[model samples]
Target: MAVITMIEAQKRSGRFNIYVDGHYAFPVSDSVLVDFRLYKGMEIDKELEGRLTAADDVAKAYNRALDYLSHQLRTEKEVQDKLTTLEIPEDTIEQTLKKLRDFSLVDDAHYAASYVRTMMHTGDKGPRVIRQHLRQKGVGEKVIDDALVLFTPAEQLAVGTAVAQKLAKRYQHNSTRNREQKMRQGLMTRGFGGDAIKAMLDAVDLTPDVDEQHALLAKQGEKLWHRYRALSESERQYKTKQALYRKGFKLDDISQWLADFGESVD
Candidate 1:
């Protein structure tokens, strides 16, 4: 048994240093100080000392968790991982999570729903990518599924069409077929499913005007012509034909462009 010699306030707010028998024993937050009712000349037995330290540990861990949640809404797993990094004991971390859940401060369902809603209204991410993101954040599959109901087929089509249209513009210099292909690929990469991709393709108009197609072909063909310049004339024309064909130009269109190109060069 030891007797409390002093109870001194710490430089940090709401913390106190406990001294027992003229030697520093432990430090505790103000809440713990009040709960344990420690004062000078108070007798401290082994059990009481253990209780005070254990309670102080919990208090500190809880406070840390509250501060962590203050900046933004966090997943329970995120909070648990954070407390674990601080070297808080597993039981203490569990207790802190329970306290947060009890206060409705950390809820995976609410987080999942809010995330899905935000993505549906303002983001270009498809349902699959959103689900993957939520999974990585440690949200359960069931919660993600429930949340995804907010992203209906109509909403998916609307967003996918908008994204596909933007991608088509990026590939506008290519042939219409090539632009459609690139837009499909971009939609796929953005997590749109095949059905949604097909719908988006149908919705977007990739066909350039006849004059625009000729101009685009000329712009692309000239680069290939310059690229194979060191080869023999026959070899350069052959290579240019193959390159432009692979770039989604029709055979007839390639022939016309080549004839026009030959005339321009001569």
Candidate 2:
């Protein structure tokens, strides 16, 4: 048993240093001091002291969680992980989590839904990538699934078409097929599924005009012609044709370009 000798306020507000028998014992928040009704000359047993400190721990953990959530909405796992990093005891962490949930301050479902809505409005990530990011944040699969329902097929098409159109413009210098292929890859990278990407590709106009196509093919064919210059003429022509074919140029186009290239060289 020990007797309280002093209750002194710490430099930080709302916290106090507890002294027992003329020696510093532990520190607690103002709320804990009030709840436990500690004062100088009050007698306390070790068990009661344990309970007071435990309550203080819960208060600290809960306050820290509130501060963390002040920046943005946080999942329950995020708050739990934050408390764990502070070295809060597991039971204390659990208690803090309960208090937060009781107040509706920390909820995974709310976090996931808000995150998806925010991304849907302002982000380029596809549903799969968004799910991956939410999962990494420790949101549950079911919560993520429910939240992603807000990202409807209609939304996907709208966003994907916009993205695909932008990609087609970026790849406009390539042949029609090559530009379409690049747009497809770009859409996929941005998280659109195959069907969504295909629809978006179909919806966007990637076909270059005849003059643009000819110029693009000629530019690429010239580079290839130079690249294979070291090879025998037959091998060079064969290599150029194969390279242009792989780049989405038709065989007839390749043959005509090669013939025109040879004539121009002569």
Candidate maximizing TM-score: 2
Query: Per-prediction TM-score, please?
Result: 0.85, 0.90
How well does candidate 2 score on lDDT at residue 241?
85
Off by more than 4 A, model 1: 1-11, 17-24, 33-44, 262-266
How far off is residue 42 in model 2, in Å? 4.8
TM-score of 1: 0.85
> How many clashes does the backbone of model 1 have?
0
Model 1: per-residue Cα lDDT at residue 250: 88
User: Candidate 1's residue-wise lDDT over 58-148, tens digit each?
Assistant: 8899899989989988899999999999999999888778878998999999999999888878988898899899999999999989999
> Global lDDT of each model?
0.88, 0.87
Per-residue lDDT of 233 in model 1: 87
